[model samples]
Target: MTYHETVIIRAMNRSRFTVQQGQAVILAETADDRPLKEPLRDREGKIALSGLSLSELKQFMKSLGEPAFRADQIHSWIYAKWVKSFDEMTNLSADLRNKLNEVACLSALEIATLKVSRDGTRKYLFRLPDGKLVESVLMCFQDRDTLSACVSSQVGCAVGCTFCATGYLGFMRNLSAQEIVDQVLSIQRESGKRVANLVYMGQGEPLLNTEHVIDSIDTMIHSVGIGGRHITVSTSGIIPGIEQLRDENLPVTLALSLHAPDKQTREEVVPITRKYPIPELIKSLKQYVEKTKRRVTIEYVLLKDVTDSEEQARQLADLVRDLHCNINLIPYNPTFAEDGAALYDRPSRDAQVRFKRLAEGSGKTVTIRLERGTDIEAACGQLHNAYKE
Candidate 1:
C-alpha cells in the first residue's frame, strides 16, 4: 500500500470506525473521558454523536439500551437546536444525558486560534482531538449579506497542487463526517448568523473523501437545514470522484479547479492531470452535466504569465466551449515569494480583464471574483495551518 494509505490506516485506528449492518462500532471512552488510549487523546474515544445519522444514532441508543424515539429527540437537540453540550439537551432525561456523556461526545475540534481579515473573513485554526490542526474559512459577503463556510475534508491535502499551501502539508487522513459538519456549526456560532452557503474548498480535495462528504451533505441538508443547492464540492479534477458524485443523487454544485487549460500546463499546475487526463476529465464532466442537469462552475486561477496569457485564455475558452458551465476567474494568491522563485503571483489587472473578456466572448458566463481576505490570508489558495512547531 502507498504511504498515504498507511498513514490513513494508522490514523483511523485511533479515530475512525466502520458501520456493520446498520450498526456503528465506535471506540470506547475512558472513565475520565479523556478519549481512548492516552497516546490518541483525540483520535480514539467516544464517537462524536453529531456525526451519527438518525438511524445510526438509533442503533447507538439501542446499544445503550434506550428506546429508538430517543434518537429523534437527541437528533433534534443536536441538529435543530444546535446545542453545544449535552447539558443543553434538557428534553432528555438526566440519566440518559449522563449515559450519553459516558458513551458519546458532541465535537472534537477545539479552537486553537482564530484570525479575522479586515474584510471580516474569519479563519479558524481548530485543534482536533489527536492534536492535529486544520483550517476553515468563514467568508462574509457583506454586499449580499451571505455567509459561506469553506470547510476542510482532510487534515491536509494529497493532490499536491503546486500553487496551494495545503498541498505541501501532504495527506494525513480524512476528517470524519462530523468534523466536516462541525466546521459550519462552529462558524455559525462565531459569526452569530446563519450560514447561507457551504463550500468544501478549504484544505483538502472533497471528492477524495466521497463517503464522508456525502454523509456530511446528508446531515447538512436533512439535519442542519441547509439546502443541497447551496453546497458546492470543489475538486482538482478527480474523474472517478466526479463520476461517483453523479450517481449520488445530489444536486449540489460541482466546481472544477481547472487552473490550466491543456494537458501539459494542467499537469504542471495540477498533478492529478497525470492520472486523469484533461480529455477523460472533460468526458466525465460532460456526463455529470447530462445526468444532473446542473451547470458546473469552472474555477480558473490566473497565475501571472503562467496561466493568464491571452492565448491560454483563448485555449481555455475553446476547451469548455461545448460544456454547460460558467467560469469563475480567481486571481492567484501567493503563499510566499523568494528572489527568483515565487510560488505564485497574481496576474496584472489587464491580464485579468483580458482573460474574463476572452472567456465571455466564447458565449459562456464569466465572473471575476472579488478577492477577499488577502490581508489575513483567508482568500482562495491562501489558507493553511500556520501554527508551526
Candidate 2:
C-alpha cells in the first residue's frame, strides 16, 4: 500500500493520530471502541465545566438536586470575588464544595511567567492546560485611572503582517472562550485591580475566530460584568468576519487594523489583504457603522520609510473619512528579524508628529498611540510565539 493509504488505515484504527515526517502514527485507541473502565482521559486536564455562565451554573446545580441559589454564590466567587480555589468560597456549604471539587474546576490558566514594565504595565504568560502558552498585558495609567488589559485571541496569528512577531509563528488553533476569559482574570488577579477596558489586540486576529471571540465577549459583558462599551475587538480586516460582527449588534467598539490604504501597499504589509481587498473591506466597514450606529476606529501602524509617507497618510485619511471612523496611529515597535540579521526600525519621532498632523488635518479625530512596555517586549504589536521556541 502507498504511504497515504497506510496512514489513513492507521488513523481509522487509532483515536489519536499525528502526522510527522510524511507518516501517520496511531497514538491512542478510539474512545468509542475502548472499554468503559478505560475511558479516554484528557491529559491536558482542560476544565470541562468551562464556559458556564451564572444562570447555567444555577441550572446545573438545580439539575443535580442542589439549591438553585448556589449558582449565584458560585458565580460571585468565580468572577466578582475572583477566588481561584473552590475551597476559598466560604459561603458555599462544605457538601457542595466537595461535590464541586469532584467535577468542576475554578481556574483555567496557570501563570507561568509575569513581567512588569517600568510604567506599571504588567505582562503575563499563561500556560494553558494543553501546554500552549499565551500572553496578556495590563496597562495602568495614573492620570486616567484606567486599567486596560490587552488579551490574546489565539496562541499565534495566521495573518502574516510583515512587521508583527506573532505572524512569524504562523497559525496554531483558535483559543476557546474559556481560554480567552482566563487571560483577563489571570492579569486582574496579578495586578489586584479591576480592568476598566479590554482590548482584543494582543496576539491574534479577533475576527478570524469569530464564534469563540463573540462568545468570550458575551461572557465578559454579561457574566463577568465588564461593560460592552469598554470592550474593543481589533481585526486585520477579515471581511466576512466583519459582516458577522455587524449581525451580532454587539455594543463593543470595532477597531480595524488598516496598516496600509491602497491594495498594493496593504497587501505588502498585511498578507490577508490579498484575499479581502480594500474595496470590499471598506464596504463592510461602512455597513457595520450603519448597522451598529457606532463609530469604528482604524488602527494604522506607522513603519518608517514603509507606510509613513505623506501620500499614504492622505490615502488613510480619505479612507476613514468615507467610513466616518477615527484613526489611531501606532508607531511600529522594533522587533528582531526572523534571521536575526537586523532589527525592524520604528517610525522616527518627527515622522510620527508629521503623520499625526496630516491625519488630524483631515477633520477626523486622530490619536497617536503612545508606546508602552517596550523594555519587556510588551508594547503594542510586539507579542510573538516565544513559548514554542
Q: Per-residue lDDT tens digits of candidate 2, residues 243-272?
A: 888877777899999899888889999999
Query: Runs in model 2 with CA error above 4 Å?
Result: 1-51
Q: Write the per-residue lDDT of candidate 1 for residues 140-188, one digit (tens) a residue.
A: 8878877888899999999999888898889999987778888877766
Candidate maximizing lDDT: 1
Which pairs of residues have clashing backbones in candidate 1?
14-43, 15-43, 42-129
Every candidate's lDDT? 0.80, 0.77
Supply the TM-score for candidate 2.
0.86
Off by over 4 Å in 1: 1-44, 337-341
Model 1 residue 379 CA deviation in Å: 1.3
Against the true structure, what is every candidate's RMSD? 7.2, 9.8
Q: What is the C-alpha local distance difference test score of candidate 1?
A: 0.80
Give the per-residue Cα lDDT of candidate 2 at 246: 85
